[model samples]
Target: MSPANPVAGDERRRLVEDVIQRRILSTELRPGQRVNESRLAEELVVSRTPVREALLRLEGQGWVLFDHGRGFVVTPLSTDEIRETYPIVAQLEQLALTSTGPALRGLAPVLSEINGEFGASTDPARSHDLDARFHRTLASRCGNGRLIALLDRHWQALHRYERFYMTHPDDHRRSVRQHDAIVAAIASGDVASAADQLVDNIIGPMHVLLERLR
Candidate 1:
């Protein structure tokens, strides 16, 4: 082979990361569980190098922790982390929506459509995706790069927690309603109200987890 393909290796590494990350988020790889490099490499049909690289990157993202040559273990979900992070995400999203300006005002129909899909979604994974798209669409227009990056980072944990919490029909309906309210607020050009909804929407479900952890 003429010079090992660096690009192929990078792509394979990303593929490993995506699959492993999904398992982590979906709880197939529960918190504190060990990650077996050999098992994963065989399962993924790639060499160990890419899998190892992917795990290292995920460690940087706080998704896992190294066990000092014993390989990586999935990081445990923390109520404290949720309590601290949700508010920060909420406040930053508020700022993003408020400063996003009037362009989003005209995007009501698009937002409403997404909310409808979210409500009608039957699959858990699909619902989670639609839910993210709904928020991402609105925040995409926020005109602030730094705020958006932070929101995306925090959302990694938030998405998994929300998925875990939104298992009941009641929870799903409630979330859909909250999403609708946020869309309506944006449509009416009331950034304050929309931002307010954003904060409450996040904290409402979070409060339940907090209670359970207590």
Candidate 2:
């Protein structure tokens, strides 16, 4: 009945958004599952307003969709979605890395270390996290906040797909090698080569996931 505090409302909306995004990315919410606004509000101890607002924001981010009768549901994964989204994300990441310029030189060691752990890890979640970290770190010095944010959103959207397809043993080995090559290129001050390798790192698994989807 009363008015909501503006600051508190913003905080709650962001919190709700992040929680839902994480669930979707981890596949805990799952593809095509209805997102119950009332239930999520109760679980998060927030009002339905924030939950609804967050879901709407997520819809814009391609994480969920508003169905006429079913309300908000997790966006179902499809080969079409993969073909459309993966290349865009790959290009954005390539741009981010190329734009990072000399700053990427400083991150070469860090990226290599992360790739090492990513390859060594047996846990899917940990490996996924490390892989995300590697890509993010590689582009962190790009100095373009909007570009980075956009890339992060796309990366998170693709995370669910990547996590789902990570069961293939060969994919794991191939990713490690690709990441290693990217790091090597970066370490050698070959930014163009690193960017090319980074695109391959992304598009390579894209084909693998498409095959698995078939």
Candidate 3:
């Protein structure tokens, strides 16, 4: 198998990480799905070593679980896990929001562009991308590399729930409006309002998802 792009060892690891992360988050790899190492290596055109390494990383991150006889299965999150995670996520988002200063002002236009695309998007896949981008951009500005990395990991772990919300018609519509509120609050430098709006935006859809799962 040929590498699509030539990259060094660390870069190749990141590429593998990205591939697995995206597949899991997009639900291409559903919960409890067994990860076929050989098949994945063949499809991704990478050696088994990197694929194994990637799977190990994902397992450590709680996105995958080791089954006694089944090898690695995508981790399934319960409603309780979702509920337990939201408040922690909210607190992290609030920290990021409060830490924002002038550096974040540059993100305003990018956020607006993403919001515009999200509003006009009729494709579910495209909408999910936009949604991910919006939150990721917000978190990336927190000025703490470790915090940002942790959030990225959490985001990937929560992707299944997030996608469920994004693909639901009613939830998607509500998200657009809520995203606007968040953007407006941030643009106005109302940190507290932005934090509250972020929590609401996260928890509201999560409520819908939890109800559906129940």
Which candidate leads in TM-score?
1
- lDDT per model vs. reference: 0.85, 0.87, 0.81
TM-score of 3: 0.81
Runs in model 1 deviating more than 4 A are none
Please give the ranking of all candidate structures by TM-score, highest first, separated by commas.
1, 2, 3
Candidate 3 lDDT over 86-205, as tens digits, reads 777777777886787776667777888898899988877788889989988887777898888777766766777777677778778888998888888878877788788888988887
Best by lDDT: 2
User: For model 3, what is the error of residue 65's alpha carbon versus the real structure, in angstroms, after optimal superposition?
Assistant: 1.3
Assess candidate 2 and give its TM-score to the true structure.
0.86
Q: How well does each candidate superpose onto the true structure, as a TM-score? A: 0.94, 0.86, 0.81
Cα RMSD, each candidate: 1.5, 2.4, 3.8
| Tens digit of per-residue lDDT, candidate 2, span 114-166 | 98899998877777888888888887889999999898888867877888766
Quickly count the clashes in candidate 1. 0
The superposed Cα distance between candidate 3 and the true structure at residue 209, in angstroms, equals: 1.7
